[model samples]
Target: MANLRPISRVVQGQRMKEGAGVTICRTVGTSMLRNLDPYLMLDELKLPAKAAFAGFPDHPHRGFETCSIMLEGKMEHRDSQGNHGVIGPGGIQWMTAGRGIVHSEMPGTTDGVLWGFQLWINLPKKDKMCKPRYQDYQATDIPVVESAPGASVRVMAGEHAGTAGPIKMRNPGLLMDVRLAAGANFTQEVPEGWNGFAYIYDGEGKVCGTKAQPEQALVLGPGDHVVATGGSGPSGLKFLLIAGKPIGEPIVQHGPFVMNTQDEIQQAFRDYQSGALQRPEDNPWKGEEL
Candidate 1:
């Protein structure tokens, strides 16, 4: 029998705002659960359809990567590297701020729903200052697998049913968006020693036999797999299953910069202030395409 990992801790997200005026629910990044190995923060951004001018503006990040997933609505991304693109519903943008980069994430009106998540993934000590890169994909790029009737799993940055996502991470990790109909059940195997957790964003469900409500972050204990079942309610359930290998290094973070030491964090700030973050030759995009 497969060992199901039970929920060890449950934390509720707090309402917060980012950029100029975007509202979000911050699930991670708190002092209690500051750093989850290679993973850092996870922000759930849910806005109204007319939420124009309510998005993240130009900002700098170094020694880490930002992975944004669009569950609904449309979002446009522009960066100092000259990368510009628009990701619609179900699209994803993985930005690697290896050394340093300035970027903005603006929103556009689409349908009635405007929901998304931006996950901050920490880079390893060796790859902290590597060259910046990006991995952008559309809704059709990701693969969705059906485990059983009324249960679907969308592989974002990991492997599922022999299919793999295109986004690559320096530190091994897994990200999956799952949806289950009422009374449906879903299970996924997780590698041992990898820190794993689940964030329920919609409806009700039971993770590892523990009842969970929306906006709850469930930390998983040591086990080989996790069992999640939809609640008896009519709305079903939706969540993001995230797991990553622990980097096991010193973590020094200040605002958008994440480094292995305080001196490195200070240097990142200095480089940004001196405009030495990105070289002219480093940018491959020339306002044509991203």
Candidate 2:
């Protein structure tokens, strides 16, 4: 049995403004250290309104894959592949930054609220130089299973109950968006031994034999499954459940680039500044006429 590792702490995320007027929780991305190893960073971007969250400017990346899942609004994306489109509710844009590429994300709607999470998953050492690719999973592509009568699990990786996840990776990780009504109880195995965590997005619950109140994110040491139980009240319970194998390597991070060594990190920055990150033909097309 995977050790029943109880939650150690509860850290909540707070919003802050950044590039292009994007508002997001400053803490969640930085606090999830190794909760999902191989998957290095996660930023929860939530716009109070579409006008306020204009999205981000064109950017360069290498040695990582960006998993952008939209929970509320839409995000317009374009890349060097001449690919241009929008990913809305239940949608995901998995962009692999093997060698490198330039891309941009802009808000899709002119009205309404915009909310989503961008998770940066790490690639293995051997695949660092692989060519970049993007896999767009439509909302219909993801499977939703009933974890219980009123509780369900949206499996993104690994497995949950009898359903297998659609995503494939060089790493062993699991991303489950769970929702349970008040007074509901649920349980599931998280492999034999894996590092796991829970970020409560709404309502409240208990995990690993401990309580996880709203706005609190809990990190588990080592465990098989995160057994959660919700309470009876005016609110329901919702959270992000994640698990993965540890990379067990040195992490040298510089801004958006996450590598295993300080030298590699420096090289990444140099490549970007020296105009060596991408080829001219692969230059990402700029949509707007300035």
Candidate with maximal lDDT: 1
RMSD vs true structure, all candidates: 2.9, 4.8
Q: Per-residue alpha-carbon lDDT of model 1 for 1-290, expressed as tens digits?
A: 26778788998888877888777888789766886787899999887856645677888999998999999898998877777899999999988888888888888674576789999999888888777888889999999989778999999977876778777777888899999999898888888888988999999989899888988789989988888899888879899999989889999999999999999989998999998765543454221122
Cα lDDT tens digits for candidate 2, 26-92: 4345544433566566567665654555578778888777888888888899764556889988888
Model 2 TM: 0.88
Which predicted model would earn the best TM-score?
A: 1
Alpha-carbon error at 134 in model 1, in Å? Answer: 0.5
What are the lDDT scores of the predictions, listed in order?
Answer: 0.85, 0.71
Clash counts for the predictions, in order = 0, 1
